[model samples]
Target: MTGFEGKTVVLTGAAGGIGRDLARAYAGRGAAVLLTDLSGEAGEALARELNEAGGSASFFPADLAQPEAAGLIMEAAVRTFGRIDILINNAGFGIWKPPLELSVDEWDAVLNVNLRGTFLCSREAAKVMKRQAQGGAIVNIASTRAAQSEPNSEAYAASKGGIVAITHALALSLGADRIRVNAISPGWIDNGKFGELRPEDHAQHPAGRVGRTADIARACFYLTDPDNDFVTGINLTVDGGMTRKMIYEE
Candidate 1:
């Protein structure tokens, strides 16, 4: 494992499916983790467990929907773990509805969490990194659904599309400050805790099997490595070639 010794990482959605796995993966590499989630108790428990296991971790509670939550989480991270080296904006939300059927509130909810929240976290992290003169990495967890047609998913799709845009835009703006920003478009990752995907979801993919939390988490770890300074402004598709599959008319 790449040693992230003494590196501090702040991860959002740390209590969720992929988020939890990402936290463990980072800690395993010797990084001190600041785990944030809406579930206060769960986040605390997970952080405590990692600490007890000889890894450094701390729990921070925040509702990503709130504008202040992002700043709060980052501030807490800096206070607890010192300067942050990596930030994984992995908090995600989705509501299945067609454009016409989607309520404005639903659209705003998805955008607020998936897009605005990412903006907040990265903005705060950039300020810290720029001041410290230490380059940092940010990994935004988008989804394959961004480019594909998932019926009744207008809001989610738009939000993810925004992530791809945000990653590159921020990457360019932050490049001068020595900060790298990238996004990961995950496939159908079956965490067995939340979310859903029938067997049919996997049959169409070239991988022939649904992805797991570990797959996405592994990618996040790589993107956030301090030793990795060359990679930036990439929307990495970890969707098992599903995006390239030819689904021509029969």
Candidate 2:
């Protein structure tokens, strides 16, 4: 945990459930965290909370849909923390509708933020990390939907699938620079409604419950840990074994 002491992390989509916890995890571990999101209010509040608790944290408002946002975000991080040691792409949204009704605009919106944003941010961070002697780590927050689908998830699935593809490709390209790239595909992570989940909901998962933000946070720590440098160019599924179980009606 203290391994992150004195490190700098840039995290996107940091106002939401998973993103918020991810921000805390990094800040709590001694990383000077730059939290970015569309919600400036939330981002600022979280940053304030972390700083009040004696952790180094700051907030930057951004809309990944904008082509210029990535560069600005990376700049803000470097300006605040002096260097980029970790980048977490955790910002994404989905537009669910019948595939026939899913307009090109909707699809574009999803890809722009989920897939394109991931790529742009990684590229910008890599530019900085490459200059540093130790290099850095990038963890893209993909989803289980990248591989499995429920219904009417074409755009969402496509974006996540693209994340996985770019993850390995970036890994291969950045290996020589000592920058490790990886992806985490989370399955059914309960944001804040765990109390409302029914018995069957927990039973359905092979792990006996829905996943928490902490689960993905732990995975992030593991992947970015310098000791685990051997781990790269892979997608680690953090689902509660839901992807492994075969579901069928009796």
Candidate 3:
């Protein structure tokens, strides 16, 4: 809706499939979007595309794993858009190696980018939001794996679990400032290659289909809307009810 007409949104991992859609969704809603990703080329391209389509968007290249990157990105957003209205902690990756074979370094890498980066970015954004005296929203991209998991997902699962925890903590700490914090746990999101998925893939979920980037985008909008201020400190699972179904093998 036009609710975000004058808002400023800072999104991480802007080059990925879901991130790209997120950028477009905000920009389409009349928000000034500052997109960041390690892949400068992709991020810049997306920004350019949005601008060319008559939307306000800028690109900043930064590695979220670096401690200094969060501050720099927040500064860039303020400099470009004047203030930060929203921060989407969507940058993360998983190293799917068996626990026995997974190195300590690999574990650190996942946690650094996924968990640590979310906290640092949220902290920097909250500072600006507090100063503005206007409440804001921070949505951390967690995953269903936070509560449930499969083999070889130790690092990824742990990072997501941490995100879910940090979300509530931030919510309580920032509640006084009117800054709402929440997390979204997405499951089986089909970023691309939807055509290749089989019938069983869609049937497996109770909703009878996989999720799309739009699903997550809409959820973000709902959480960040000013009217939804009461919906903070919770994790919204947007997985088409896949997480609730009980499947039994015959």
TM-score of each: 0.93, 0.98, 0.98
Off by over 4 Å in 3: none
**Candidate 1, 67-141: lDDT as tens digits:** 988888889988998888899999988999778888999999999999999999999988888877677999999
User: Sorted by lDDT, highest first, which candidate order results?
Assistant: 2, 3, 1
Candidate 1 regions exceeding 4 Å error are 193-203, 248-250
Candidate 2, 200-239: lDDT as tens digits: 9999999999999999999999999988899999999999
CA displacement after TM-score superposition, residue 5 of candidate 1 (Å): 1.2
lDDT of model 2, residue 219:
97
User: Where is the poorest 10-residue window by lDDT in model 2?
Assistant: 1-10
In model 2, pairs of residues that clash are none
Lowest-lDDT window of 10 residues in candidate 1? Answer: 193-202
After superposing candidate 2 on the true structure, give the runs of residues whose Cα lies further than 4 Å from its correct spot. none
Candidate 2 vs candidate 3: the lDDT winner is 2
Best by lDDT: 2
Per-residue lDDT tens digits for candidate 3, residues 150-217, read 99999999999999999999999999999999999999999898989999999888898999999999
